[model samples]
Target: MKGVAESRDRSRSVLRIGGVSGGVFDRFRSIQDLAKDPSIHAVLFGDWISEISMTFRGNERASRTPDAEQVAFEMSFISALKPAIQDIAKNKQRVAVNAGSCDPEAMAKVVQQLVKDHGTDLKVSWVTGDDVTTQFKEMLKSGEKFPSLPSDTPIDQWGVEPVCAQAYLGGVGIAEALRHGADIVICGRVADAAPVVGAAMWFHNWGREDFTELAHALMAGHLLECSSYVTGGYYTGFKKELLQSRNCTNLGFPIGEIESNGEFVITKEKTAGGIVNVSTVTAQLLYEIQGPLYYNSDVTARLDGIHVADEGPDRVRVTGVVGLPPPPTTKIGITARGGWQAEVHFFLTGLDIAEKVELVKRQTLESMGEYQKEFTTLTFNVTGSVAENPKNQASATVDLRIFAQSKNPDIMSAGSHKGVAPDTPSFAKWVIENCLQGYPGGTPAMDLRQSTGKPFFEYWVALFPQNKINHEMHTFNGMTIPVPAPTVTAMYPRQQVSYDTSSPLPLDSWGPTVRAPLGHIVHGRSGDKSSDCNLGLFVRHADEWDWLRSLLSVGKLRELLEEEDTGKKIDRFEIPSLNAVHFLLRDHLDRGANSSSSYDILGKNVCEYIRYKKVDIPKVFYDRGTI
Candidate 1:
């Protein structure tokens, strides 16, 4: 129950903070529920803005008049905090969040108004300068290049021009805002863990060079950043029994109790639903991270040495987190209008599913004729399959999707079919005309609106010099504080760290093996970072770790996920403490979520698909039971 009041004395050991929101649509009740807890010193909100969101906000901003009211920030946070303002004030709790997204000034104003209307004296502050669009454009004009993260292709060669760009800020600005007596701090596009790191920094009065303490706080932020993610939301071990035994319906958000010695315990409310154990913590630790060294704007965290252990029923203690100076540059995401994209689906039922798909593809292309050449990208994918001796019609049906994108909107629009004949050059006309000519049991989906093109965006992520950003913090009392980039930074090369686990003993040493899905003995979590996907696979038992490390390599991963393998480079790393091996599949998500036609655009299900792939599992491991 150690709170902010005790932490201010500088002798107190722990600072407790609750994670209220993970993304744009997370539950609003989290804030209200957590703010009422006396043990909770502060509530952190991580409103993650993906590439598509940035593009959508940019388009929205462009469409507005000069004098029009701007509400570009994530308004859901305000709605969530409105009802909790009184409780938060009464408890004297602090608040930090990156929900400001594209507009922190406006978001801060709204929060200030809400606090005033609620008759509370909670001071609100905002951090800005993450928006580097103008500066980025100027740098581009000056012949400076910003290369793409995966391909290393310069901006000049990208073909598309960025409409909006935002640099990822660190926690320094947030800490500065807190130092100026601000109870609430709003920020635009700060790192997801910045709010938590800032809160810890302010509570413990940690200096900039407190790398060890900062790194611990950074990892704590990461664990709590995704809210229920560390509390079994996306757990791979969600079986029927587990779901029934635990209250999966109302999963609780996580809270971090960080000690002064750079160790912390992750737990949730005792009365709330969901389980918080080592497995959940390990799964989250391995989620969305690239390699052994997890880089943030403030500190480069060495996660390879970290250990997670179950302390109690709903508590997992994390320790041994090493810290290094951050890199000189921070990541910046640039969003550009790519073009128009459209898709049409045809249902394939019963036998000859493959033949039906081919027939539909041939007919649709032939019907489009020369118009097919106009499309920038066109794909024909047959998704799912019928079960042998299926009992139901739904189980016998699959989908044939024809996805197309073009720089020319007419090429993908339904209006192009207006003046054309049934066999003429129109995307919609082509699919509809194939009705009778297609294979047996083939029928076009009733929803033809997809045939009409809609604008899509291309997202580019790369590193930008942190010193170039106009990082500043504006306090509630009109005091503006300049937050400088780190003076000391290590230039770590962008390469996978070498580990002993990479060269494991031969497969025969593990004993006789049985052909089974990897998920039978292994648990995994997958997530997207721009176009690249990071898949972290782990085992519960120490004996199984060797088998997992040896069996799941870059080659093995490619073999398992052959359909997704784009011949792109894949990097591998290991975390021995967690008995995990992680893979970075470069350019795997097909230009990422914004423009990807992939069903699993975010790459969240990549691990599940890989787990479904049959692999050789040691008999002993298989006997232990499925994860």
Candidate 2:
């Protein structure tokens, strides 16, 4: 608690945001420990419903009546952090969050009740107007089309009903609310970095044109937006080394000490677990980024020129952030009712793993009979490996997974049509019917219920003009403010940059080499943007920069990907400052997290998967089995 107060300098401000929702807090320590510092100006929360959450909700078609259960689920942090709410009042610090997914007004009321229950009078406000389902529906009626950014596929081709849609709002509304004396601000779907941008602008009284400062604040927010991401939470690449430095079980969340000029040093609370350095900061900076140009509602932040340098123990100074005017349009997340999907996993152990998988697939289809035609899409994949002289049965086993989806619920629910078939229709039953008769050594990992068909949603992301949104800020007392439009207008391009085919190098120049995993010579991160996935690979040694740059070009990547490369567009960029190569795989994950059938919809494992790809590493970079 004492360290929290001293954690921030008076000139700058911000704390690691807990997460996208209060639900994330449940998995961590008590909220009181998070807000124990009095000197911290404000605590921000990003609770805006994510695209994945909306797909899971599936109740968008229901009446607009406020579902108490849903509200509690979204804003559960209010009750979860009741003590912290009291602490914010005691410290007279401000708090801003987009905890209200679709209903900011109701969320604001909940905050009011919580403040009253805590016996502390605090001013609160809510920002709204992100919802545009009505506007979208009207546009659709008038023949306006919304296309998926990754594939350019029109919404009509998705073959799903649009349920609910929300536009990504900016930090302007949050900043205006603070200017009107609101102690706590609640919002719907602002950008993930909006809270930090708003707080920094409020503290410095910065105008919209303060692009440079705003961009710096944007980076700070992006770094802390995922809470513990910058604090070794996702730094599991070198588990033994990272785990030794910090007990990741209770890893301290990141905190940004933004100086007056917008440059900030990312660090953790005193005596807290987790390490903060150039690598950790770099990992978070590259997380989920599309490219050098990062677009936000507030400003167009450029990241290609950014710099990260170690400054003392567990501290990294991040500077050189440049910004442009805000984009002319804001991105909108649209969710539609997709078909039903069902999947089952079978464990094939030891000998004849490949033969056993083929037998299982054959029997499964035979059992389905005519019912197999009901599915629109069906796929089978084998995971894990059977190695020579394996250590244990678990390691020797391979998991064969089957997935299927269909627009007709009945078709997906249909069971075995085989002789003396079970009474009701079910895909789970069909898969289980083969369990006893096929694949001599095949066994399902668990119960069949998990593989039952369930409804899924199609996610479509597009850009809509900012002027179209009817945004507003509701004050604590009884006033409303219309958010001003962006001073500088711009539009987001389809792609940030073209593929880098300029750098081509002979494959054999580096001398005696060993075929090994790329991870030993390079460390990097990967994440998803809609259906596209980006992998940013970097080498720590300066000497390896040229080799890495020349070696990881788009052509080299295609060679590495082998048959997995579907001939889709792959763009690569060079980040010389970090000696990193960034790649964006277009339309790689089906239709993104909501509808993608891949296990790794977010592409978090792309880097690890790529790292393990067979590569001829120069002998000099591969010393004693590691770089």
Candidate 3:
């Protein structure tokens, strides 16, 4: 708490931020919320999680419709939150967005119409450069050829059918809209992180590859893109306090304070219904993190040497973001045929949670044994969302869940049919007499999805620098500000240098390139650690790669390393050639998740192992490994 107050060095001139989140569905709500503020220099949206857009325009008859999948994407962000955005525009507050999902072309028309209806002099343009579904089809119709990824097979053989095909565009497309004198810019499939970063770059007139400037924009965008995550939305325990303190219904939007190094701290406007604390920020830092390296389509911002300090009240200052060059390839969202997947959830509240779960498990297994079902697969769970270990408590309750999948229709039908609930002895007595909707209501149908397509790094992220993506856009009415113009700039493009998929960009993420000076290169090494202590760090994007390099360059980095790793400056060593190992580190103390740079929930020993990497020190070390 003491450190939280001193977190922000007021002497510094960084454009700080309020908060951030990774969920894509907040686009509409965020826009609606922030739109009310005329003081906002600009607005930007970074979304990839949901397809609110497909819902807004009311997609193709179910046959060709893209799945909503509960994602919070742009299209929905805007339409759902239109009233608030209009109020912002009327107030003359500047805003922007890239929440169009894969329908930028259609979204473009929507924006023009929306602006016109508002009767504000706000000129609007829907930016569409990456989505080439029509272009690809036209080419195929006329016999032009194109090569597909992996196989490089001709378009005809690839059998490409995109309900939406938006190429991730960058600053160039954004600038295109600005040049046309558009007030609100709309884009589809741009990098989710790019819109806000682009807005900052445009607002500050920051150029591409101006490492620090690029870092600033990247940092700002990162903090404000997510709606409530930064502002008590997903805050654990903190939300209880916020809800108790203020109206939970009026959730606040995140605001950011960005610096030149692309480091930012998030805090909402005062009296807002959210709490900006270390846990919320750090949770997001570790949430969905692949590992040490984090990537996205536009740039890779490294978390090395990263510091997050809560600066009292609502301020949280963050630093040490490393930036590197972007990769040459782009990541494609390939939803390949994943077959049929379905989930069912039910609550069991009468008795012991464990007891209830065991009974359900036993019954389901027994049913499977009797039928020798060929097309059914199931795993029952006691919780929801991301998995967590169950804890037993008195009168404990549980939400039972079942997941199943199959490819054959007839064989699957043998498992369970729809329009009727499955009756088993454990729950059969409860269901037949008083059956409700949620318990095994329908037969499983074959669901198909292509894999999350992996694209190259060249695809740029576009932003409509005019609005935030919001889910509950009605909140914009609270503020009477008018939204203004668009602002944007792209991160430096990835340099050409490689071919290898063995190393993925971090983990779950399928993107982006390792930046030059930071990504996919071989650099300095210790003659001591190995013949080649030289390592290759592939982050999710260019920003992360660059940030890693910066962390190693800090004045205290080498001094600290020398004292700890044996009186020698291991980072000072150099080598003849560095292939794909991105950058050189004079002294890098690479470690696992328990690094002291992060929250230390572990005992003191593990803390020291993270802080000093000591076998034994002033304090004894107790490792999680030991536990």
Candidate 4:
């Protein structure tokens, strides 16, 4: 193996790394494609686990013995890496992944076996200390309070015990493994961007104090972390014309070329489909982020000053990211069994749709009588609206969904009622019995399986002291190294940075206004982090930046999203570099994806919903063109 200095001098100043997987089930073939590319130095995979996945894996871990061959890690990663191992070894490239959910040692052992099976000499390593479920429980018993991110409610007051907890490890351990000559490093629940940051750290020989470079690398990793997200997938500008012009059938995964100076260019394979431009990159930058300050386990990145530009076709350059000291603590996710929940849907067609829904809701509640009080949450939601003057039966139909949850499984159980009266039926049965006594044109959905209750998990995100984590890296050569937490750190109080977009004239001063969808001149992307939702909206021209920043205030957003707004706090910020206005809606998704009964469980539809809303827009801006 060549030394760091020798390798740097021998190659270009840029380190090219490919991102193959965005989630656990992402395309497996991309791994082989990137591994065969000699220009790529390494491959990084992100999004292996969430709170719900952790809960499922925690149960699996609890049920399994220590000597179990098939432990609780992402098994799909093995299939993805099997065909790519020989290519990776032949090309002399490295690989890093967080597919080691709850168990990195087992994942590493599996990879080592694959390497041996393929007759490859590539070394394997694994990072530990991320699964701190036992330690977390011990701390809780010792009066350590882990406050929930959505509501700041302490664990004790949560009314449930956590089954598992995982700390977000940084890139230092990964870099240590790479430095010790490990060609592959498997990790458990590290920060999503840790692999990219660690690979860059090893390539550049950067220390923990190299804040600026680390920050830039952090943003680079963020862009590549979601794979096709930075390369036209889920892009707001994905229109029919763009689709017709470009082949998006098999979208390519992204590649980040990080320079020694910290600036990086994002691009994809030449033979692959999908487009990479400023808009795609900017859309991804705003995805799942709360504010201008992007907190990573390694560094706190200030994104307000970031600059993105189109360098060439299928390439975009990102720079000007400011870095602050690492936070003293990192986010830890704790998972607990929430309860049982179930729902039944009824279809209402044609005119008098609202009346039909009301009739059914009244009947269902009346039948439940005092039994309704036993349910923790019971909601009757009417989704969609009938079309005016009916074009077809399908278009004129709407769904009235009845969702219920309870701590007592019997309350939501699929079996006949046990406690309340033997004559009393299940929740689904109560609703279905009303079918004969229902309103005009009322029919229950065919899917009766969903009427049965299913268990769900609640996720609590809180900060844990980094020093408490037993961060370590174990190599194939039997070397174990301890990775230390950053000594230099800063505490940033939770405060929103408001941008002054005051205009000398009023909003209507531009010209005559027309009531149209906000998407006519705006593009947006929204995503959920726990229960909070971040909606990022941007415009095409620089001239419209001030108008956008001024128009989409907290009050305006609440007004636009009035139905979804539950009187929760909303944080607003501006990214002037991208001509974007971002808003964070706190406590928006009913306890997040796992326990959420909302139609938009992941909150990905919030942007489209807001964009579809009709709002008064400057006709001049619309004249330019719709996004």
Candidate 5:
């Protein structure tokens, strides 16, 4: 084996990698930009995976051969990327991606074919064995158990049989593919940041013991993994006046220049839209992370003391990331047939809105009667305000959404229910029949498909020991290299830390106060991790940090999310360096993304919603407009 000091190449040490897509539809313009940048060593595309991949038909057969339609859906990015791929080949650069959801080998063949048709000699290879749908069943039969995350419940209690399963593979296989001269490496079900880590490790010749370098690259990958997120795409806190100037609509994807010293500068295409600064990087750092330890299959990133510094315009330097050995296990996403779901909305508007809602609900319940009993889950969500005012009908109208899900598909079907008599109408028909009897202005949405039962999948995330996985690298020239197990061990904290009881100066001491949305003085970013939701709240001014930390305690968070809290566990952590407070709302998402019933399934909008909650802002800080 070549040592880190002797094997690395430094001419391309800048490690310029641009993120093309977060999923299938994320910004595609970056690919062309990547092709134009000769210095860029590689291009990493996150692409669509898991529940998102399920949108394509035949995803359940990911372990098997994909049909032409499935292959077309999976390789849709390649069509737009052909010209870019040719440019990359001309520049002698490489591409690493996890866009090959279930059939990476097949995707690689298509890519190779594209290269051949273009008359370029670029080689393509794909990593395999991430698909564990068959192995999972074998393991379960042999007495292996895969417990659910956070809850630690037995897999059987998940209430659905897994249709397809995949383990989060490491980046080593990708590196091996690169080492064997593969110009493009396609992967399936690897962690989102694997491509960056793989490319950085391969370029720098970093060994397993180079934990610090790996950690830096991991954070770099994390910052760049979401494409435009680190480049002002979600930085709405930048005041309307300032944000509008950046023309965020045509946001550019990020490029990280990672170095061997374990430090990197995050910058995007200069000609593209959006801004990059300490604020954007910091917000992205605090996005969707779990506590202090950010674990990946390759290595664990200790983010307790991470720092983001403003180097210059459109550039941010991230440093101080600590690294630990890789965890013993990897997270496996087991997708199961959750059941079927059906939803329809009734518009309730104007005077007597409350009465109209109640009338609609009462009649809907009565209409379903015994049929409702067959539903495994049912919900009534009333959205929008009926504030007293002489406003337009649109302002006064509220959407009363009725949603139901059940393992018994017939229960949620448009025209059938196992429990109901054959002659009786289905729930949809019943609801329509009662529309005439409902409130005077009640009207259901015109889309009839919403009332029909459609299959939904439950995403059960569990930890599977890395050693049990059959991970390997498939070289461009038909050779396979088995990936070794991680050298490090990891164990989560046995107990969570209780909230800090320290008190701060009273709100009155900060001078005059005004009741307004907390967003005016604070910024927040929220995202989902499995069934849990991570919410990071930050303040622009150092002086305001203390106020934010003390004011938004667990108790305060509970009060703010009281209606939606549902008595779930909440863990809060304070990061003084970033002037931020992070909270993990356990079991907040009804289930994982695929099975979630909420409109904001991924919880991406939770931060904005929390920002809308009214809170007292000190007039002094409020005046600075830096909040």
Candidate 6:
């Protein structure tokens, strides 16, 4: 295998980093910090949208109410300046961000509204014509049909919820956003490279036909997207304190200074308390990245052109990046409701029980025969209590999954306890989803996804064509309910309100300005039986604060808006940090360096040492302050 390594030379250098900071969206930070210095030429990458951001007006903070995503995005434009609107006023520079999440069309209008409110008659461009949710329709209309993500299997046998589907389009769509004389651009689901690509393309007036140069710029944007996470946040050597001063709080965002040749250095703010050495950058460069070679929504990059070296205490420069030609077909995400599915579990076991299992299942089926016929279909698969992932945990490899789905509600009532329980496994044990709350009756049929209902597959990246890229955001104006109401307590005199900060409510239960982790729902989803899944969350609140306090409190507010176990908090990581003790099985379970990523498929390097057994990763990232 090729060893983990990097090359340090004079040519590969980072003079500056282009970045958009703050929390969730770019609201938490201001470009003024970087603009004050001559190093940075532009600001980039602002994520707009979170429970509060899209619904409310800010990233969840300890002391916040909530606002709207549109408001948050508009506010970010101000932060990217010497003075509010000054950069755009002089036509000096600007930044691009995914200001909208699920709906781009609405995002356009939101910006248009903001501009109008500003009393400026800017000829805003509302770019549309792309929606992955209707990928099937687009393909049909274009006189072609193709499979969906990953394996892209024929849709004839699959049910796909076009929840989020769009190819990685460069910022070209925002071309119109710029051409209309709009200083700011808002897009949805554009590839991470799109903003940088769009800005460079429009800023330099590069044509769509220049594949080689655009590819280079696109590659640089890919390198800058994760900010510190790519730099020292996920460095390879933390033992020397690379992670010591890392302000999880200040967590520096990424910055890039692209040269005319397409090479760019990814770095962060000065005195930022994080390490930006070659090792740290090299690790970041390798993340989620496929090979020594680099790939982007636009082109395949020749990693060989890249270079790295220390320019100063915290600055590490990058240079030598080149890109190849683009692909042919476009990618799309079409959501035509997948069918319905309901599952009821029956816990049963015998010391020598494989034989008894068949008897019990057959008996249950006979009774539900009518319900089964009504539903149109029934499926029976078995495994372990850990019914989903088929990893190393197979000690008890016998479990059953009874699933059935149908278009009609009357037909869905088929798998009822009234239908399957009385028939077989008379002493049939435990059941969920079917026997609704103490009262055994038919439950509402849900679209139980095969990926979530069970542990199933491995992880892989699916790269699609670019023409399918759309950068539009839509806002569903509704009184979003809190996951679990933030148990409120008013502190009148001091102007304070206390929230549980651990709101334990499902995404659907979310209240205005509050949302569960991004793609959290996708965690429980099983891609296949053989893949081990790791779970984590990235929450985005769309709005920005007029003052500084808003950025400081998103984390606190998230906690406050949440109730105990009512929601997942960043503080859930307490086991090793809060104590000085180790458990009997600590060696086997810690996710650090030795223990497996429990269920992590993203390849997150969370734990330090377990299987090999140690409190710290021997040499990687460690606190130098302690030593």
Top candidate, metric lDDT? 4
Off by over 4 Å in 2: 1-30, 61-73, 414-422, 501-511, 624-627
**Model 3, 1-627: lDDT tens per residue?**
011122212353454322223445443455555556644544434454322233222223113436543332344545644676566566554445665565554565566667667666676555544444454445447775444322234445533233333344444345334433455666655555566665545444455555455554554565555666556654434424565675466566677766544566677866456677664565444332222333443455655445667688777887666655443334332211223434444566543556655665565555555443443334565652222433552234345655444443332332244433333222222212232322332221222111111111111112211122111111111211222222222343222222222323432132333222211221111110101112222222233333333333323333433433323222211111111122222212221111111121111122122223221111111110111
Q: Return whichever of 1 and 5 wins on TM-score.
A: 1
Q: Candidate 5, residue 514: CA error in Å?
A: 2.3
Each model's lDDT comes to 0.84, 0.76, 0.40, 0.85, 0.78, 0.40
Per-model TM values vs. the true structure: 0.95, 0.91, 0.53, 0.95, 0.94, 0.50
The per-residue C-alpha lDDT of model 6 at residue 381 equals: 54
Candidate 1 lDDT, tens digit per residue, 230-343? 988889887842576758888888999999877999999766888898888999999899888889889989998999999988999999999899999999998888898989
Model 2 over residues 418-531: C-alpha lDDT tens digits? 342346766777788777787777678686665767878787888877887899999999898899668686776767885673655676777888888888878778888789
RMSD per candidate (Å) reads 2.9, 4.4, 15.6, 2.5, 2.7, 19.8
Residue 416, candidate 2: C-alpha displacement in angstroms: 15
TM-score of 2: 0.91
- Residue 258 lDDT (model 6): 64
State how far residue 427 of model 1 sits from its true place (Å).
Answer: 2.6
- Model 1 lowest lDDT segment of ten: 1-10
Candidate 2: lDDT over CA atoms? 0.76
Candidate 3's displacement at residue 599, Å, is 27
**TM-score, prediction 1:** 0.95
Residue 235, candidate 1: Cα error in Å is 0.4
Deviating ranges (above 4 Å) for candidate 4: 1-10, 63-70, 416-424, 498-505
